[model samples]
Target: MAAKTWASATRDGGQSITTTSVWSVVRRLIGYECFETDPEYLLLQSIYEDLRLYFNFFQPVLKLIAKEHMDKKVIKRYDGRAIGDHDTAAPPYQQVMAFKDVPFETKARLTNLYVQLNPAHLRTTIDAKVAKLWKISW
Candidate 1:
């Protein structure tokens, strides 16, 4: 019904609307038709597409979140994308939690094991094994 009404509306200064220009305002509002040339908008669009390929289960997602605000900073940057710097400086998966507080021998041994198996594949294998051990099927 709305589309039907929009198709017959008059344009600026009482001019008849063209067939292609009917509902141009609604098209821009709903589809961001005016942002076709926006750089940040295009970048965000690409990021959204790429993120669709990444899906994973997170471990330890508990309310250790409360510990996040333990350290106060001089100023909060508000929005990461606004500053154009969203890098968390996280180490690669193989190196994550590798040498934390463990004795040199143990750390090196575990790190050697992790490196032998690629970290990404190793995580899947571990998750599968844990599921099997717990009789989890999905």
Candidate 2:
């Protein structure tokens, strides 16, 4: 399992950060960037378990989905600002989920497809569907 870490900068010229610290920073960032009343977060939170189970074995696929469906400009800004500021690693989906614009139906589809697909055929199905929509082959 990946450890949740917070991203931070050291004021006193300290050593580099660990994974845990990076997660802490990201959580704090999201606290401000995302809202408590946001329905997207609530929806994603509700299905987090299903997402984790299904995507756990297909992180690359999820990344591909993010690349295709997520807002590139916003993600670019995030990477340049918040992500660049972090000294430790952060999972791609954490940043991807920050986009509340992604429809709930898409999330549902991604999660449902993962649950229904067999492992051996998972990538092909996902790739084909995503490629058809995004016009890019994996």
Candidate 3:
């Protein structure tokens, strides 16, 4: 999952402000607009996507671990669009959309993963992944 991106020191030299990602903003939007639960579909989608991206960032290490724990095919299916059930009629795949548009609980477990990751590690790790994913250099 995307980590809080911006941070600042307070007047007392303590950590002050922190900012998340555009993706996180989008997740919150999903909560207010699409899913009403605490951990929305978009959030879970972000987490799933980040997991793949970060695995690639630390290739040979985390990649192997992710491969061992998560099936390639299954992880590929974490496209956020498959949150709930499948409905292929309404918006092409109405069944899938309907399934994906359910309560946030369907995607809440991912939130636990996000909360568990250390903020410091998450930020550095995600930054590395994002940079690599975008093919940029230091």
Cα displacement (angstroms), candidate 1, residue 59, comes to: 9.0
RMSD of each: 20.2, 18.7, 17.8
State the displacement of the C-alpha of residue 129, model 3, in Å, after optimal TM-score superposition: 0.9
lDDT of residue 6 for candidate 1: 25
lDDT of 3 by residue, 56-79 (tens): 232222111122235544431222
Off by over 4 Å in 3: 1-48, 51-115, 136-138
Candidate 1, 112-132: lDDT as tens digits: 754564446544554454334
Between prediction 2 and prediction 3, the one with superior TM-score is: 2
Question: How does model 1 fare in lDDT?
Answer: 0.34
Off by over 4 Å in 2: 1-78, 82-84, 87-95, 116-138
Tell me, by lDDT, which candidate is best.
2
Return the candidate ranking by lDDT, descending. Answer: 2, 3, 1
What are the per-residue Cα lDDT tens digits for candidate 2 across 1-138?
233233456545443322332344334322333222334333323333333443553443222212222655534233334334443433444334556887888767656754664645644544444334233211
